[model samples]
Target: MHAPDRPASYAHPARLILILSLAPTVGLGIGRFAYALVLPDMRDTLAWSYSAAGFMNTINAAGYLAGALFASRMIRRFGLAASVRWGTLACVLSLALCAITGNFYVLSFARLLAGVGAAAGFVGGGALAATIAQSRPERANFLLSLFYAGPGIGILASGLAAPFVLQGFGPGSWWIVWWAMTALAVVMTIPVLLAPFHARAALTETTAVKFAVAPVVIYLTGYFLFGAGYIAYMTFMIAYIRDAGGGAAAQSAFWSLIGVSAFATPWVWRRVLALDRGGLATTIILGVNAIGAAMPIFGHSVWLLATSALVFGVAFFAVVGSTTAFVRFNYPPQAWPTAIAAMTISFGIGQTLGPIVVGAITDALGSLSFALNVSAAMLALGAVLSAFQRKVRSF
Candidate 1:
């Protein structure tokens, strides 16, 4: 008799993706975006100026860039699972520190540390997911999508939980949110611990692929601007809502909608991602996101905010995915790592500049709405740049 076939669950890669995804969920969802939820309270309780608040995210973005630079080396040294495990641990510790301190400098340091940890976890988790995709080539896209969707799960959970906490514990206890996030991070770390790790052979040959900025300059520029524009909106959104007289209930609904929309992004954009028109895919998505980012400034109706959240949520993560797709279509497999790294570094630089600049604008104008309009203008310019890109051809 033939040996019994492996059970579907045993053979399927979903469980592995599920486990790996927790890294992004915590790293991005709580470590990064949760600041938006916590910011209003932090401002009121801590008596922080808008510029000071913006500087916190600016330092965090700088840390994220610094961490990204070192993440590849860490993955090589510690291996993927260990890197992810330790990174998650560091992130939780950072969150815990944020809870314990009310000092401005100390809290800024904590956000910066959290950014570093989040970047490490994000990089390691993505590499692990790529390894799994190689092993299960047929389901590669779906599995990767599931892994990327982890942030959406984190966002959803935070959006749902934060309002309740704020309502129950009151706004003065913003530190409670950080502690709660730390607890969730502890739970999320379990899957990373349980996931199996296998060593792979080292790459023996280096392929010489010449990278030229002129050929894809427009696309790269567009992506960089996208990094700059999207972050400003995300960093200040909660405070903006509160300024507009929105209550916790409205905030919960708006943020949760974004999370829910994010969960459905892979399916929505699968066809668009297949496009190989140099920067067309990215151009379209960025345009949509820019509209979402600008909507609140146009009007403050409940329907407008909800629509903005849904559209913004749907396109936010997928914008990064578009750049990955661009690299895949334009470069050989061996060149992917270098191209992606270059693009990521550019994106990180843009993010580092975005928050502080927006903050300065807000401080000058005394209007978050004006800052958001500036963000939308940047995104629009990015779309224009992306529109000029053509598929790279042999010289």
Candidate 2:
């Protein structure tokens, strides 16, 4: 087994992982998900059609795809810790950019930049987290979940505040919300910068392992569907809440619930994430995630919508953790970055297409409900495809 890479500031692996988690907090939670919280406002203030709003996220996903394609090179050139830090820095700077202007082109560029940084940060952070987990194999599942769940803190903080900022400042105050998110992102990024990975990780990067794709194509395909499916739910669900007569308080509660449930993900799926089966862990979580996405389809009841938020939150992040566990189970440490990047690229492509497609449907139908249905169906299909994949040995 490889030696630990935890910084000297924290002797405990879990604690180090927790600090490292701040990368995703800024990269994903603030950079990626916060866009959803601000989307409705942007659409209203910018006078964007659903398609235009969706384009913003699509461009961001495009950035994510680009970043994923190059993540291995970034990791190779700069190492894990540097990639994570630089990525978070990009995200923080981008968030500040979101506040400086209402120009759609500028905002789109910010979203695109955020996606690029987020992909790098998320990919690097996941790989580094996997490395730390390697040092404590028995507790690997728990540790990995903690790292993946880092976005929940970003979600929770932003969820709790972004909605109120939008409501309190009222209407065009969306830019103010972005400033608040920027401040929060700055705070969250501090811990990630302070934590440097142990130098031993450089040993594993010497010869890059080829991306694992052919043998696990089915599993990868399922994950691609997952990427496609989940973003629709996240990107447009806030609109649904508003459509359902949910105001600022409702949005705050709903988004915050997701963040809360997201934080609880490690405990909720620890045992499932430990499974060695190629897609069994992914299947279970994706199934749960499908259920969550579908719950909002039945009616406009507050209980119904909130239930969807909770179920979706708990399972969504776990699906990401499951993919990491899949790589750890089937690939050697040297291949982790390449393999993770491959999975990310697949996921990224799916997400890249999702928002625009789903948004088009909403625009065409004049409702987000049908789009939600399509999102649920995609996830269900992903679960089915994943079920066909069984365990395989690491090379």
Candidate 3:
């Protein structure tokens, strides 16, 4: 048994931290990550061109970028609770609107709204978690890991849920899934609202911290490459599998495998960080992702797909954990948010362009294999960047 004054392992403080940390994951993962899973279905139903679908993703990333830039001020002015509630409400409403209509313009608008809401939620939640973890470094690191795990969980949940929901309800039932997701979002918001807001000085700082900006910039570049490869894979993996003659069960299983692997990321990276060579670890993870991206190009076999998913899953979460931890260790406490925001914005930019670039590549080559290869190349570039980043400690 643990000491009573030690916050009781996994009790109030731990549970609260976990819950709040999960808010961004649900907000971004469900609202954003799930969008890709459903896109193929939506495209078929709505007769959307590839460019149109890609544009939707770009719009969302744009909103997320804007929200990240402004969210700190919003939280400072309104407090964490109000910001969370407002963001949740926006997400719920946007998803609801998406369910009710198939108009391309309206769908784009809804996605934008959802993106903005998700961004706000992510920024606020991350800031809050960082604040709480400041004094309790171990707990803080755990909470940070938990925050990123939300998306992996969301991806797994949606990947499993989307196919069954679509099959059971028949055509045009994508709206039903959206509505259900909206309901889930609203329900999840209740717990968040009830939880006490533990304000910390680390949460409110908007100024640049002590780290040299150059290395941070290089890190952002690598981060951008990561976003491109990861998003492209996530956005199209299910469809790619299905297109290659895999059954619905196979597709679902593939995503589940990815999710399960992703779920272990925080635990794995925690050990990696203990080595105190986060830069090298990051390079290795990015290289792994590049290899994963190349797997599908070899063949469309089910075994290959499964292997690719697992590799991608492990690499994806590990990279996120390593990069975020890198920021925490390298930067001063006050500048953490700005550094994170800067990195996230670079990610958003990559994500914003990735889908469209993939779509264009697919159009040109008439196969996802080419697109996957392009993504692999980008990951390779990121790996190089990661290695180069080690020389400069300031950024």
Q: Highest lDDT: which candidate? A: 2
Local lDDT at 187 for model 2: 86
Give the TM-scores of the predictions, in the order they appear.
Answer: 0.90, 0.97, 0.89
**Clash number for candidate 1:** 0
Candidate 1: worst-modelled 10 consecutive residues by lDDT: 199-208
| Per-prediction tally of clashes | 0, 0, 3
Error of 3 at 134 (Å): 2.9
- Give a tens-digit lDDT track for model 2, residues 171-261: 8888999899999999888888887577766556524876656788999899999989999999999988987788989998888888899
Candidate closer to the true structure by TM-score (higher is better), 1 or 2: 2
Residue 31's C-alpha lDDT in candidate 1? Answer: 84
Off by over 4 Å in 2: 1-10
Give the per-residue lDDT digits (tens) of candidate 3, residues 128-214: 555555546555566667666766766677667877787788777889888877777777777777776654332345444443566
